[model samples]
Target: MSRVLVVDDEAGLRRALAINLSARGWDVTAAPDGATALEAAASTHPDVVLLDLGLPDLDGLDVIAGLRGWTDVPIIVLTARTSSADTVDALDAGADDYVTKPFAMDVLLARLRAAVRRGAAGEGGAPEVVEAGALRVDLARRTVTRHGEPVKLTPTEWHLLQVLVTRAGRLVTQTELLKEVWGPAYGRETNYLRVYVAQLRRKLEEAPAQPRHLITEPGMGYRFEL
Candidate 1:
């Protein structure tokens, strides 16, 4: 059975998640605040964590950092904040994924399963490298380089680029990119894509304002052109 630590201040949400997940065969542990969440995480050592950003004790990003300090366990942020800045902040703080508030149960479950699958995939994989123009992505190494020069990317930027480059020359729909990179609760978060895509263009494109590789389809989605 996979262990999951669900951290949210809302008693109703915690109970609902625990009951639903437990029914699905997950060993669910619930925490009402950041302190308890951290304690549960340290002791329970769950395979995944569903954390809320609005905690009474510690900010959700801090909890993410704390976990990252010792464990590679996947951390998914569950928050009501719809701002792209908040989403980026969570991802930059080491969160593997983010889910917005009032999310559907089935969507959240799918995200959890995806996170687990990714964690497993990372453990045993040969390097898969994708190239576009002068940019190179080492999928296994999770590193990107432009013109043989290493480019620093935040976790969010790397994930966005990873999805695009892996599907080079294909038009990746906005919803597909959001759900794949952020979480299932993010299909409509277009601003998140805008911010991260611009960041990626700045890092990987020779001309960000007039990008040649990362092409935007405007109202449709984006495509990676080699």
Candidate 2:
């Protein structure tokens, strides 16, 4: 069974989630604060973590950065704070996904599945490097190359790539992309998306004006074909 760590101060919510997740066949673990959650994560090594932004002991962003310092274990932030800035902080800090409070269990399950798939794919990468025409991406090491030379990406750019690659070929909603890549604060900042898209095209696309992999869906969102 896949292991899952749930961190929330609300006793009822924590217990309910533990029971529900257990019913779904996950080995569930619970913590009431950030410090305990971190300990549980490091010691138990869960496949996915359900983190809450409002902790009794520490800032949620700190928890994300703290875990990132030691592991790539996927983190999904669960919070009542719907602000885009809150979402951006968590994502940029190293969270894999964000889910607002009063969320549906089915949607949460889907996010868990996505996180698990990405984590598994990260471990089972091909031995040799992969190329997008002249641009080469090292699947195993999470590095990129252009014309056989390494190409540097900003931290935000890398996170965006992670989201795109995880949902490749599917049209990820603009709000979802922004939440995944930038956080909740940027979910409505379509301008940020436009700027980042241009930046990514300039670096990854052969022609910045016409992109093949990074595609826009008009009023919808973006998708990475590869």
- The local distance difference test score of model 2 is 0.81
lDDT of the structure predicted as candidate 1: 0.83
Cα-based lDDT for every prediction: 0.83, 0.81
List pairs with backbone clashes in candidate 2: 84-184, 84-185, 85-185, 87-183, 87-184, 88-182, 88-183, 88-184
> Compared with the true structure, what per-residue lDDT tens digits does model 2 show for residues 75-175?
88898995666766676577777778899999998888777766776677633454557877665678888777777898888778767765554456678
The number of the candidate with the highest lDDT is 1
User: In candidate 2, how many Å is residue 73 off?
Assistant: 0.4
Candidate 2: stretches off by over 4 Å? 126-163, 166-226
Give residue 173's lDDT in candidate 2 (0 to 100).
62
Task: Write the residue-wise lDDT of candidate 1 on 144-187 in tens digits.
Answer: 88999999999888888888876554456677789899898887
**Residue 81 alpha-carbon offset, candidate 2, angstroms:** 0.2
Positional deviation of 190 in candidate 1, in angstroms? 14
Cα TM-score of candidate 2? 0.64
Distance from true location, Cα of 166 in model 2, Å? 6.4
Instruction: Name the top TM-score candidate.
Output: 2
